[model samples]
Target: MPTTQQAIPFHLAFPVHSLAAARSFYGELLGCPEGRSSADWVDFDFYGHQIVAHLAPEEAGHRQTSAVDGDAVPVRHFGAVLPMAQWQSLADKLRQADTRFIIEPHIRFKGEVGEQATMFFLDPSGNAVEFKAFADIGAMFAK
Candidate 1:
């Protein structure tokens, strides 16, 4: 729907220990809504992308974290930069759902370059997703 140039909406698969827990985390907690679900795998609409949670307990703890803005960000994370209005709506929805956040939603660089609302949270499968929004799209690449 005329997303950004780099936003064609891709598909991804991640490992999950429990399907039911993953479903609750993505479907209920994050409110991703459901797509296709099975005993070993489940598909979810992750911010307009297709994400499948495959049952793979062994791959659960194999992720590494990298330093980012003084936080240990997951090395294999994915998310999107939603519009400001959508960001606020999602923030309220997350609050209503009592979503546990890895990084609380807030402005990172207030009154500076790249100022935006950012938040990090993990699904039941331990996959990290960071949602960010830029009030001024031009500031996305400011220095």
Candidate 2:
């Protein structure tokens, strides 16, 4: 008998300013299906991972940053690593929606180890989300 390996999905719980805004951003805009919810929080099926957004107005936005590859990368952020094509499609959709990107979609670490396409943007509550893709999936963890 042969054994198959399966990828494990992660669970992340973050604060949001409002549940309505979270529903619109994560559910309607990003296309993540909704799951169980309460008056204070909601769950989103984020690219097969479980992400829960809890209402906490004071803890919603990222205020710190670090310099990375000449960009002020948000110190606190979360997102998915998608295939190249899917990443591009999502980028296009975001552009079409007139999203204000904290880091515009572009190739990062060009001609170097772990080169990839990436973008970053904030949600309605100012939570940072980064989406990225690797030309060669095998190089995702290359040194």
Against the reference, the lDDT scores of all candidates come to 0.83, 0.95
Best candidate, lDDT-wise? Answer: 2
Stretches of candidate 1 exceeding 4 Å from the true structure: 1-7, 141-143
Models 1 onward score TM values of: 0.80, 0.95
lDDT (tens digit, per residue) of candidate 2 on 1-143: 33224588889999999999999999999999999999999999999999999999999999999998888999999999999999999999999999999999999999998999999999999999999999987788778
Model 2 alpha-carbon miss at residue 136, Å = 0.8
Candidate RMSDs in order = 3.0, 2.8
RMSD of 2: 2.8
Q: How well does candidate 2 score on lDDT at residue 20?
A: 97
For residue 5, model 1's alpha carbon misses the true position, in angstroms, by 3.4
Stretches of candidate 2 exceeding 4 Å from the true structure: 1-5
